[model samples]
Target: MNADIKLRVSNIDKSFPGVKALNQVNFAVRKGTVHVLCGENGAGKSTLMKVINGIYRPDAGEILIDEKPVDIKNPIQARSLGISMIFQELNYIPEMTIEESLCVGNWPRDRYGRINWKEIRKRTKELLAKENLNYNPETKLKELTVSDIQMLEILKAISYNSDIIIMDEPTSAITNKEVEVLFQKINEIKSRGACIIYISHKMDEIFRIADEITVFRDGCVVDSRPIGEYDLETVISQMVGRKLENNFPKEEIKLGGEILKVQSLTQKDKFEDVSFHVREGEIIGFAGLMGAGRTEVMRSLFGLDPYESGEIFIKNQKTVIKNVKSSIDKKMVMLSEDRRRFGIIPVRSIKENVALASLRKFIYSGRLHEEEENKAVKEFCEKMNVKAPDFETKIESLSGGNQQKVILAKWMVTDPDILIVDEPTRGIDVGAKYEIYKLMTELAKQKKALVMVSSELPELIGMCDRIYIMSKGKVTGMLTRDEFTQESIMAYATGTKIQKEVK
Candidate 1:
């Protein structure tokens, strides 16, 4: 044990009924440095972090903080010992105001032992302002966007002023600019001699902020070294256990007739006059900055949100889609950007979640054919390479990547002609991302129309046949494959340049 070491774990082992989440994992973090944890989803990075943060008690291990043994039996104990964690899953009281949420754990008290509401509001306002978060403290958290909530989570962790801060996929839902701000905050924390344990699958962030890097695979440490000792290839190879030749294995496909079209879709203040089309076998992309109406447009198109006026056509026939079932009946399905909220049913089993959207196929003679449903679920799960303990395993227990696979499988079983996938690879690792890209390319080869909405520019450029750039509730520019560059896309996204046609 070194005096400079802020946190240390020796031979930590944790397990659940069917999974050994961590196997004799040993790791150390030095004060005043950022230690990055990189691994594929289900690789036990989160599990290890949970053990350290007291969310999960390790079955066997010795945890030492500052050369002293510590037993962190719960989150409260961890926090009391100067440890804080920002979870990947957004957990907050939706009904609570921003100020109430931020001041929940540590509230200022008056002389009478009651909460000092004024002081809390003042402090929360100051905190938000310092972070450049232009949000009202009185606004309920449920009213805020996902990106804003992500920023708030970062702020909440930073507010603790702890000795050790653990952040899991902090930038998964945020924009690049917000990520820059987060990095700056992290650096400030580092300057104060605090230790940061950052868990992310993003290579760019790993390279930018990590002082030391540790790779976890299959619930064990594969490698741990300084940032200088590893390149993107080495880190990725260790994480995925193979050389991924292409993160985006996009294949060219022949264009067919327009399968779906939206003309002048308006959602009052949400989005306006949004028009796009997806041809059979063509992958169309929607690229924009955060809150640029890309998601709103997709939501309206899927009938998740009501639009003031719009005309939707399927195979050149005007169709009125009143709800999700209506859209599904028309052979259209959507993979929402916020998967936790909209995509998966967390409390359900793997088989049930997979068979959710396509239940019609399993229901015969006024009953669900259990054997038939199970067979179909098994086939699709295997096809998607979903890693789960069993068909009965809870969907919430699976890793982020596997959960995404199940969601994809859910829609795939529906045999949709048009798939509107929003942020399909949001929080998953590079390996899982590659798998999804391969799947999308396969779908395109089958002449299925796909519309992809992504904040990641390179993904859109690599996978999209054509891209429509949205800015402030309108389609600012449309680019074909030849013109699909980050610069051109940003030009339209930021409203610096707008092209009228899709050429």
Candidate 2:
């Protein structure tokens, strides 16, 4: 109950159908300190954050603000009590402009009792400038990229002037440079005596910014201690309820002939003269910084984007893939990086989503085979270890990792020979990431070609047989396993060393 304690939750309990999300959880944060929460997906970290922010009222618990017991019934109430949050999933009005979204609930008023448009623009410009973002105040929210939106949300939380700030995976979609800027801002906020409850699955960030560490496992608090008291191994062991044997369980598969080849692929301003190839039973990686055209090239390859001049060969045969259907017909599949936007249908059941592309296989006698479709969906979901109440549940109800698993199920149902996964583990926990890596390895062993695009260089170095570094719209460097290094990749990604020939 000391004043130095900025926020506290005692005996917090929350539950949903078929899941006890939180069980008598206890957490506290001191003023000016960064308190980090680490846990596997569905281990009650996100649920706890929701409870603290009043999105979900604890079934039995007490919340204290500066040692004073208070009931927070809604997010508005939590904000009024000097609480602000940056959610992992964006919750902004896409139809609105950046200025409008930032000014939500706290718009400056004019003397004539009207919304102050000019003041809103000024504040938005100031916030953008503070973060070194080059976004127009009048730009629609939907027009901004994922990283830009994340930076804007961080700026919004900082502008709240709150005593307690909850950041849920704030750096998940940002670049390393952006993360450094965010850490600097966090230090500045700490100097002003604010409490930051930081939640993330990334160990490096946790160790860098956390003053106190709390680990959650299976809805219970595993341990809490000073950051110095916990090593990386101890933290990982506590998070998954067991020691993580290997972060990347990559399998060495027998090499085969090229399964996919692209020559002189040009997507106008997005990417130009892009060239790459993936061989059977091999895992190829595309490594680059943001805006380096990795995703753009993948989109073109998957037929989600149009290219002006390019030649694509599938299994030594020239093909014209002008749309997703053609790409699928050619036995190629893609898992989009932005799952919410292009991967899953939120309102649809898992069965429908999983069987979406391969529904033809379930049709017989001019009728839809409902039972067969359900059976196929179940098979793929189980193979991916998708943890959900049932296939009947809506896709949106699952956690990010589980949703990602379902997407994998959805694509694998197509029985594609070539798989392209973009940012496969962007927002997933370490435990789930290991599972995904295992799945990718299994696919490789099965002779399915894979092209994985990731911004994390360590992931490339860990799981890839070879890496192709992209910069500005070109493939700058290609490295074999022995040639892989973070420094070498960055050198090519930043155009410092582009002497390596394109493969």
Q: Which candidate leads the pack in TM-score? A: 1
Residues 1-503, model 1: lDDT tens digits:
58999999999999987998899999999999999999988989888888888989899988999979899999888999999999888766678899998988788999999999999999999998887677889999889888888888888989889999999999989878889889998999999999999998778889999999999999999999999988999999999899987757788787899999899889888888878888999999999998899998888888898788989999999998788888999999999987787888899999989898889988989999989888889988887778778999999988877888899899998889999999988877888887788889999999999999998888999999999999999899999999888988999999999876533
Off by over 4 Å in 1: 109-116
In lDDT terms, how accurate is model 2? 0.88
User: How far is 419's C-alpha from truth in model 2 (Å)?
Assistant: 0.8
> What's the residue-level lDDT of 394 in candidate 2?
92
- TM-score versus the correct structure, for each prediction: 0.97, 0.96
Q: Which stretches of candidate 2 lie over 4 Å from their true place?
A: 109-114
Residue 16 error, candidate 1, Å: 0.8
Residue-level lDDT of model 2, residues 1-503, one tens digit each, is: 48789899999889888778899999889999999999887788888888888899899989988888999999999999999999877666678899998989787999998999989999889887876778888899888777878888898988898999999989987878889889998999999999899999888889999999999987899999989899999999999878887657877788899999999899888888888888999999999888899998988889988888989999999998899989999989999987877898899989989999899888889999898888889988888778787888898777767888899889888888999999988778887788788888998998999999998788899999999989998989899999998999999999899954587
What is the lDDT, from 0 to 100, of the residue 242 in candidate 1?
A: 93
What C-alpha lDDT, on a 0 to 100 scale, does residue 491 get in candidate 2? Answer: 97
- Please give the CA lDDT of all the candidate structures: 0.89, 0.88
